[model samples]
Target: MPLRASLRPGDTIGILGGGQLGRMLALAAAPLGLKTHIFCPDPQSPAFEVADAHTIADYEDQGALERFAETCDAVTYEFENVPAGTAAFLENRVVLRPGARALEISQDRLTEKQFLEAAGADVAPYRDIANEGDLFAALAAFGGQGVLKTRRFGYDGKGQVMIRAAEDTDTALERIGNAPAVLEALIPFDREMSVIVARDAAGTCGAFDVSENLHRNHILHTSTVPAGIGPALAETARAMAIRIAEAMDYVGVMGVELFVVPSPVGETVLVNEIAPRVHNSGHWTQDACLCDQFEQHIRAVAGWPLGTFERHSDAVMTNLIGDACDSWPDILRDPSARLHLYGKTESRPGRKMGHWNRITPHQAGNGSSGQKS
Candidate 1:
């Protein structure tokens, strides 16, 4: 049977994948009078603690999936890696926000680049590296130094291999295990930034202030608002994000990651990637904006009017990964800090256990831009 004509406050929202993102989404839904039911393969998933209900089942379990569908007024996934087949299965019974097509494009690096280019957005120069021969050809074509990233299942520097001229090309390919991948020319960028924008079915769109991102070991470590790239470049990035969201006819939040490059044509931007759901970079919005990205996404997906994008202060957000969680007491003591813990069971190295944001009166020169060196 089809989903009810429209969701009411008491209606349940079903979420796929249980992680910190889902936890935040669940928290956002409650005040709006909606309850959440979480489903994930991991029985120890952290998100289950706060959700109104949960189901521990593999993504492919048809029986469990049908039950979940029957319970939910609509479905939205926390992570993009939800299997395409699973999405297709659930969409038959429930309304899946952001839609399967958006998920399909974002889950694969190659297809995402193709889609951006087709949409007339600027992107890094890339070529498919299907095998060793293809890698060699791409290396030759792009000259020294390119990034070889897996087409699927890559995040936070995993599944990515850097091809420097000094490194043995064959060995690098072996390290990557000959996965289907895309090789992109390494960008010489002044800074890396992202735009988190949301759109609804009514064609209304809103963009959070552009944020400058700093990475450590290819994982995002900190993000700050008022990226200091000046108004023109900021507007350029936001426009790019709006175009991508509208092109997909998306009905939720999306992130557009880009490189701020300096060139003879003056500084310009290149699209690095797109995230079809709430993004890590926009975490600062929790303290700085009137409506956080999570709530904005919920509003859009529920067919409600989009919220205003009013940012009250400039803020800096830092991820508390692994041993970083040990500083929780210190973080709590700081009056300027707002902390969020994921309720994760253990703190393994490099795991994203939690994060904290510091809201201050917008200082001008605080190491604001550039990819982490």
Candidate 2:
């Protein structure tokens, strides 16, 4: 059932998966007089620090899930990997924004690609790999240069391997544990971009400015707004995002990563992947836009009016991964920089500790003012 009314102040919103995103969501909700309850298996979830309540139980814990759902007026997730069964169970008891259908489509790479293609979105050529024979055929079909990614639970380059040649196929498959995977033809693109879009229960939609992204070691390093793409291509990206959100009957913030491929006529965008929750690339909105992505997501899921998606400033967001956050003191010392640190005790390698956004007045032709430090 669709959400019939806006969630009033003081209503509790339950969040699945406790991480930096959930922590930020909890912070965003508090200012609107909304409370958050975080549910995750990790006892040291950073979101627990800001949330009004928390549950440290496994996702499959039925009793715990029911108890947690009873305390909230609505539910949303910070990550796409929330167990499908858990989401289904909660949908019956609480309002789960973006719905279980979105989760089901995004959890598997093959499913997500197929859904994008069916929706008239351009996607990289892909083949499903259920066995060694299938993998070999896919490698040959893609000219022996493709990425073999696990169909599920892969992120930040963890469950993927690049097959640069025929001889690398076995090694690539081994790296992924020979699990169910998808082989995607490597895209030769000009640049990578993402659009963060929101849709409310009322079917109203809004999209933030497209952001150009740079990734290092498979993790996002920085996101710059005003992507430098021509206005036409940017609008095209936004329209594609709206179409996707509408197709899924989505009711929250979604991040659609896209590859901008240069064609003879102009630039064409291809769907790379979809993130069902707040995305790393959208972090720049925290400082650049009147209504940040986090707040927009809260507003959407709560059945409230969507906030302004207009960006008043050009900004660049840099993620503090692992020990990169050790420079927090230096970042705080810089007056022009806005620092946001996730309260994680240890900064293990490749872990996203937090991020900072550097803002500058928006200029018509100058969007690259902020430099990553």
Candidate 3:
């Protein structure tokens, strides 16, 4: 059955996975007068601090999951890796936006790549590798040097090993714990870009401006809006994102990461990966756009019209990872920076604790001003 027309203020939104993403989602819901309930296994989940209610239970805890579903008007998840059965359980009782099918396809690298290619989007050439023989075959077919990524559960540089002609296939497979994997021919790309697109229940889609991403150690370090790509390629990136969303009948925010390759006269983009929920690359929109991706997602899942993706300014968003957050006081004193802290207590290395956005008016030269977070 289709969801009821609209969710009024005071309606509670139940979110699975409690981290910075869930925390931000809860923050966005509150302005609309909606409450958020967080369900996560971690007792110290940062999102639990802001949520109106919370349950510290495993995703597979049926009794706890059922109670959570019964208490909220609707449900959404912060991460794509929520156990499949957990989603099935909640969805059986409540409306889970973006749906289980979306999760199933995007959570696995192989499935995601196949789906994008089938939808007519260009993706890096890849082959499935399950064992030593398969790896050898893939290496021979792809010139011996490539990225071997675990077919499931890999993200931000984890679950991946580089494969070369000289490397032992048995050693590489053991490194990844003998998991199913995919080997892709590494592409020489000029730069990386991402599009954050939102779709409402009616299937109306809206896309934000392109964001050029910077990665360090396989983790996103910063995202700059108005990616220096030519106008034509920018439009192409947006269309690819919209195509993915519409093809999936997606409801809520979806991110399409791309590799911008140099074309004859300009540049062309190729799809890299699809993130089925609000993405880190769109963090700039929080201060620079009319509707932030978090709120846009809430609106979509709540049966409201998708919000505008128009940016009010050119912006740079920097992530505060681990010790990078130690300079919080200095960042806070900067007037040009809009700072956001994830409310995490520990300073683990590579952990995304917060972000700061520096926005400059369209006509401002050299950027508006450096605002400290």
Pick the TM-score winner: 2
What range of 10 consecutive residues in model 2 has the weakest lDDT sum? 364-373
Highest-lDDT candidate: 2
Candidate number that wins on TM-score, 1 or 2: 2
Estimate, for each residue in 1-373, the C-alpha lDDT of model 3 and write its tens digit: 5555468899999999899999999999999898999999999999999999999999999999989988888899988998899888877888889899899999899899889987888898899987888888888888877888898888898999887665555588788889999988877899999999888988788888888999998999989987877666777888888888888888999989999987686778889899888999989989988789999999988878877776778889999999999888887898878999999999999999899998877543322221101
Candidate 1 C-alpha lDDT tens digits along 1-373: 5465356798888889889998898988888888899999999989899999999999989899999988998899888998999999988888899899998999999999999998889998999888878888888988867999999999888888888774757677677777899999989999999999898768888788889999998889999888868877888888888888888888888889999999897899999999889999989998887789999888776777777776777888999989999999999999999998999989999999999999887555532221100
Candidate 3 ranges beyond 4 A from true positions: 1-5, 168-170, 263-266, 364-373
**lDDT accuracy of residue 74 in candidate 2:** 93
For residue 6, model 3's alpha carbon misses the true position, in angstroms, by 3.2
TM-score of 1: 0.95
lDDT of each: 0.87, 0.90, 0.86
The parts of candidate 2 lying over 4 Å away from their true place are 1-5, 365-373
Per-residue lDDT of candidate 2, residues 217-273 (tens digit): 999999988897887788788888888888888999999999999878988999999
Give, for candidate 3, the lowest lDDT window spanning 10 residues.
364-373
